[model samples]
Target: MVEAQAPLKHGGWITFPFFIATMAGLTLAAGGWNNNVIVYLIEEFNIKNIEAAQIANIINGCVNLFPVVAAIFADSFLGSFGVIVISSSLSLLGITLLTLTAMLDPLKPPSCETGSSFCQNPSKPQLFVLYTSLALASLGAAGTRFTLATMGADQFNNSTHQGIFFNWHFFTFYAATLVSVVGIIYVESNVSWGLGFGLCVLANLVGLVVFVLGKRYYRLLKPQGSPYTALARVVVAAFRKRKELQSSNSQDYYDETQKGQRNIVGTTPSNKFKFLNRAALVTEGDTNLDGTIKRPWNLCTLQQVEDLKALIKISPLWSTGILLCTPIAIQISLIVLQALAMDRHLGSHFQIPAGSMIVFVMITTSIALAIIDRFLIPMWQKLFGRSPTPLQRIGLGHILTVSSMAISALVESRRLDSARSHKLYGNSAVPMSALWLVPQLVLVGAAEAFHFPGQVSLYYQEFPKSLKSTAAAMVAVFIGIAFYLGTAVVDLFRKTTGWLPNGINDGRMDNVYWVLTVIGIVNFGYYLICACLYKYQNVEKAELNDTNSG
Candidate 1:
């Protein structure tokens, strides 16, 4: 008789602490450089304010965008553990280089005297080194960010445990980031850039080492082949069979094998995207006697067709997310510029770090996430007799986002009034307090608390099992796109209007916020339309089946 496989003792709660510690370290390391990069470029490299902002947006976009590629690599070839190890090493190297650049005067441009008419920009070699370091660091961060979440979730068997794991994952992520923004950024701004970057390098090394130490505890999964290939096949087959009529008979379609048996649950393809069902319509020569697919590109399984359908169904909802993030992206990049022009002093002792101002968003999101997960969700379930759906959560986020933009517009209007009254227009610093920017940041954070996790949950649950990692990184894809789009928007405004002039005090930033607010409102309406039309592909069925099974 064959021996039964032994259960893993090292996974579950045993591995949780290690994962948390590693994530904390990596978070601190990545956040340190990422948050303060614009400041570094402006102060050290003597780049223009708007130019630095654009570069920062592009860097943020790359950091978020590259995760999709990393996720695909992990899912299709390397698996999460291998990707994390490789990525962590890259991050360490990048941070070390950054530290060296800060410490060595030759690596940076000559420091410009305060109020100097001329400033020396970094040389070609310096720019090349800086870009290379950023590329390595971004690539490293991309690999670890969401893959670690997937790996941690894999340790749990059920959705409840997985949900709890995600909660802790995000909480730890935001908390660590908050610390970096507050502590490391403070050090960078006040003490020394080299010291701050040195800390990041140390954190990256520690995180990698801690992760390595926990290898025995990890439930290492071998990668299956690329899900994208299968998805692509479905689309190709559907197009090839476009002339063929789809059949109503279950026997006419190929049903995928599940647990050594044919899938009984999805015998009939979903009707939402009826056209894609043609891919699964089995012709006489399409299958072997054993029901194995003969010409894979010409015919696909019902599950494959359904997977494509699910993606198609969710595409409209996903598209809405891009617009939702674009305004937020624009706001985030510009806010730093706003902080630069405003009075950042809290008391006689300390002035707030410009990059650290983003901590308000992170802090608010973290707190809101905890409250929503622990208290709000329970209360919502109690009152409604069910948990709030991801769609509902995302819808609420849309509302908050619009509200935040409006509040931002109002705040900018007030700040402008103060600047004009004080005759500080075209001046470097306005007398208006930087704290006025907090409310909008907090509001945006609250919106993110609602939508970011909601998007992840929605995609994770709805996407094909093979594409889980891809689903997790889908939010990153749109956020990346939004950042790029935001850059274009900023560029457009710079060329076309005076709304985004280098000096915020001289420009009509309030108008830009108003424009974003208008865009948000329109996008929210589109989102509502999409959400209303969308039928939960797996959630309702999974819940109902669970109830029935119980």
Candidate 2:
């Protein structure tokens, strides 16, 4: 009996290399196309600068958003490994199509030379193929990125190991993105778009092959039906029993499947969301003779009730991320436009790719992650006598984000001055160096190093066991929403103010940065409030002591 109950040792540090390699390959493939897509549209598809930014924003929104749906599917039906395999194949197919478009002249719009007055738009058939390719690639990238995070973390039993994995996971992701943005974007810009996209196809294939090779060593979890369904039942059951008196006795609640399983000590259904207790109250006809629920919609288990409450409690904190990401997303898109309008020369022979300016953020983030993991955390523990919590790290992220926005405003102000002084307008490059954008980018990267892994750690640790996949994808969800919101904000600015004109040299881009700074400041205050009010639902005391110890 003891041997039968003993756990199988299927996953450990042994799976680490495969997961890291898989992440590096897939992230490089995704970044290769995604990073340079705006430029691709403008150069190949004859899209206007502002219009291309909007499309890029929308594409980015979709790429991040689809992960949530993929996570749900992984949690509900297909497991993470299966979803990743399918998504990787889809990515390969999509990138291959993208490569063909770059290679076949007929598939592309007529080339519009620099300073040309006239440009031709892509045909309807061309647009259809382009959109289809983008959709598939976005969906494929979405499914693998966050789902892989969850699956990789699942291989570990210790919280410390899991935390370390998340740190290195994001490090690998950013480092791969840096490589793609620099190397692949250079190939697309200086060499051939066909060759660049062809490389993405190869990367995707390699990632898929490497992941499949580690199948036997993975800690595979089967789908235990949809956890979302259980959450919905909790809400419905609570609504149905709204008028019922809440019970104080722990035994009055129906603890189905696992007896005495309480989220809070000495409280079966946590007191914070007391009204939800009625959902698990053992009322008449709520259960059968065998103690199973008769009608799930009318009566849920105590664990289910607690799960819903946990989500509700964390929602405000989750929402803070939306605003945190919004300004960053908008800035990222606008920086490309800024880079295009500024001097991009490095020495004399080499000119930096406008689209690759964001790679500084990736480079800084990768370096920061390594430094934070190896030196910062250990020093912090020794000095503070304890490791920093996720909320503390997130608070620091907010502060740095606000600072970055301020810096962006100042830099944009200088760039606009230089542009106006030189009388540079209508897509002409300003005399000022594009390197002025580096400080803000560096700060933003540092902010991400703090918040991204912190949020991943918090969500994974706090979320219910059944919703682990969804938890891993929650950061992606907020980032997607932020990108969408960023699009709306930019659109609003375009319509209401002359601040973000097509040619920013003819507009007040500094004003846009100032507005984002204000938004960041306001959002930071809200995040502080949310962080203070929230309590961890699933974090164990032992885990706190062991955090980042690995």
Candidate 3:
């Protein structure tokens, strides 16, 4: 299977540098604009602070949501290589438009004077250009991120190498993002937005060129049609044969998909979700004389039934991740608002960009990944006779997520107290240093280090082989959903309480963090229950430790 899929001459270590370079350029370009969009909307488009945060969250939701669609296209039609090429081109076009918006005075509203309550909004034409640019760039980014990971993983036949690739994949991802958050955001904040966006355009062009240059080295996979249709057929067949008697004999079940060669034979389905086994009962007239199914929707292969079962079983654990990520999303958006209202000076020379506060999260996550991949996993293997499992890592992430939110609540409380003491209100910067916000950001970063890659590795390892790209994309999909849900959460606070207002200093931002902390705690408890109940579907216990524990 390995040789047939990727001829030895085509894939392996030779493709690594190309893939890594492409990922670095693309991620840097994406982070350049995405990281500072809230500030752009506020400073250039004259949007309100809270409304800008909401818009940022919505944009994030779209960016993440597009990955799943991209994944589907990669798995069903374009393949990862083709998708990357097209998406990278689109990204280039989008960033060029964005640069123009930053350069042209007519494309933005007039800047508001300090301490003014009134600010003119961007004209309709300006907004149209802005949103169109954002949409194209976001769509392009969504296509590349996880689909690229899947493509990289496809280069290796060994599961261990694939796991290592995933580790480095994210490390590189966060590291590039760190650079953009610090460098590009500093330029946007301290210098000119036009210059900053121009740099992004250049990065996007380079990334696209580098990716296309590696075409020959890639071991591109052919699309396998839509895996969703196969899964759907399983459900339809199972429902059609719901009343059929159960078959205990292995041969009675249809495993014809594996009939051709080797030592494989018909296999009995597991006891769990056994009701679905009716789909593969091999009843009369189900198969023709040559053994093909006469009625496609009335019968399915055992493998198909098992694939659907795998998805169904793991769904509970998957859902816990949504709530787990929601708090982080909310915290991230609010952190920018907090930074804007606090003293951000580093010594006397410079003030940190409010948007760049997220750099701390990226830095810590990258450092954490390095430690986990090198020291921690290795040390655990020597002491405990096994490395930590993905579920264990994700469990730790859940705990840290809650801890981070608690710390955020505490920090926000102190900031609020300082604001009250100083009579800071309505865009007045508090005397407190923004450095106080670092602790919570660090914790959130550490939490992401554990869960984000863990979730990706888990899905890739467990999902059916035909859905590899989709498996890699599941994490992005949930994170996207979480961002949308985070927006709703913010709106809920706005509608129901005085927690979030246009001037955060004048409102109860601390209460918002406290509420989020409580939500995190409850969600963590639910995650514990789900994790405890879940079982590994594809890899054996020992194999999981060997391949994915890192």
Q: Assess each prediction's global lDDT (C-alpha) against the native.
A: 0.85, 0.85, 0.85
Candidate 3 versus the native: TM-score? 0.91
Q: Worst 10-residue stretch by lDDT in candidate 3?
A: 256-265
Cα misplacement distance, residue 505 of candidate 3 (Å):
1.0
| Clash count per candidate | 0, 0, 0
**lDDT tens digits by residue: candidate 1, 314-369:** 89999999999999988887788888888999898889989998999988987898
List, residue by residue over 12-123, the lDDT tens digit for candidate 3: 8888888888889899899999999988888888888999999889889988888888877877788888899889888888888999998988988888863367888778
Per-candidate alpha-carbon RMSD to the true structure = 3.9, 4.1, 3.2
The true-versus-predicted C-alpha distance at residue 286 of model 2, in Å, is 2.5
- TM-score, structure 2 vs. true: 0.90
In candidate 2, stretches whose alpha carbon ends up further than 4 angstroms from where it belongs are 1-18, 153-168, 213-220, 257-268, 378-383, 536-550
